[model samples]
Target: MPDIVSFNKGHYYLLGLGVCVGVFGLIATLEHWFSIILSEATVKKLFRVAVLGLMLGLLLPHFSHFGFSRYFQSHGYISCDAASHRWLHSVILVYTKNEMLCKELIEARK
Candidate 1:
């Protein structure tokens, strides 16, 4: 199987890019709507506040892991340590076995 760690890293990279684009769009929309009455400095300050709020909104839940960790586990979230161990085990197995047999073993494990 493809490395799950790399797969999830790629997924998060794309997700972060999407969030950047969305935040930029939000700021632009806010400036357009409020530019008539708001000063440029005020708009800039508003943008700062908006970005701060967005960051806090995204991160606050992680601060309290009481229910969140259980929710994540029940939803098939694998911890980083577990993922690294699994990947290392697979690499060792593949390296120690015959190439053709390793391929078959990997496929069968899937």
Candidate 2:
């Protein structure tokens, strides 16, 4: 059977940090473009959102399996397993519930 894989915690944290930075940069760029100065309250709200995004990034791996499983199901494939690796990188793998179907999918890719 095929399996679904998740990344290590470090990878997720880095991704979250990147996302947080991107969000802040985007907002800053928009504000500059529109000649708008964010109030203290608005800046505080943005900071809150960034922190929340970081927290979500830390939790992303836990919920990622469900999303991948649903995507496979939508494509008429049943996910058989979800695995997390302790290696120093992130990876995504999709597997079908049936061995035959898994083999067929693998062969089709070749």
Candidate 3:
């Protein structure tokens, strides 16, 4: 087994990614199930964004702290802990924007 070391970036990175993905997935799933008030087009867009966001979240751990920092360095985000914020916030926007889309879809079928 690998040794446990303090201040291991890999450990912290995994933790951050996990939290972001969990939040994104939970909110998206909740919206899909409980918000039966979206349109098909909007639903599709949300689902698409969710899938892409999920993929990004899953791959986040593979990147180094420096990589993430540099990649998002120009997006007006400061500090080394911005990746987690970016991921979660991006997903949340997608979910919120498409919330009505899912509702419309369910409403149309009724």
Per lDDT, the best of the predicted structures is 2
Sort the predicted structures by lDDT, highest score first. Answer: 2, 3, 1
Worst 10 residues of 3 by lDDT: 88-97
Model 1: which ten-residue window has the lowest total lDDT?
88-97
Give the whole-model CA lDDT for all candidates, comma-separated: 0.44, 0.62, 0.45
Candidate 3's residue-wise lDDT over 2-59, tens digit each?
Answer: 1111122344445555665765666667677787566668767666666665566556
Model 1 Cα lDDT, one tens digit per residue, 2-75? 32312222233334445656666666776587665557787677667666655654454344333544544455
Global lDDT of model 2: 0.62
What candidate 1 gets wrong by more than 4 Å, as runs, is 1-6, 33-102, 105-110
Worst lDDT 10-window in candidate 2: 1-10
TM-score of each: 0.31, 0.50, 0.32
Clashing pairs in 2: 2-95
Error at 70, model 3, angstroms:
11
Clashing pairs in 1: none
Task: Put down candidate 2 lDDT per residue, 1-110, tens digits, no spaces.
Answer: 23432223355556777778977986788689887888889888888888877877777755765576676677666543332223454544455645666566556656
Query: How big is the positional error of residue 110 in model 2, measured in Å on the Cα after superposition?
Result: 3.9
* Candidate 3 residue-wise lDDT at 79: 37
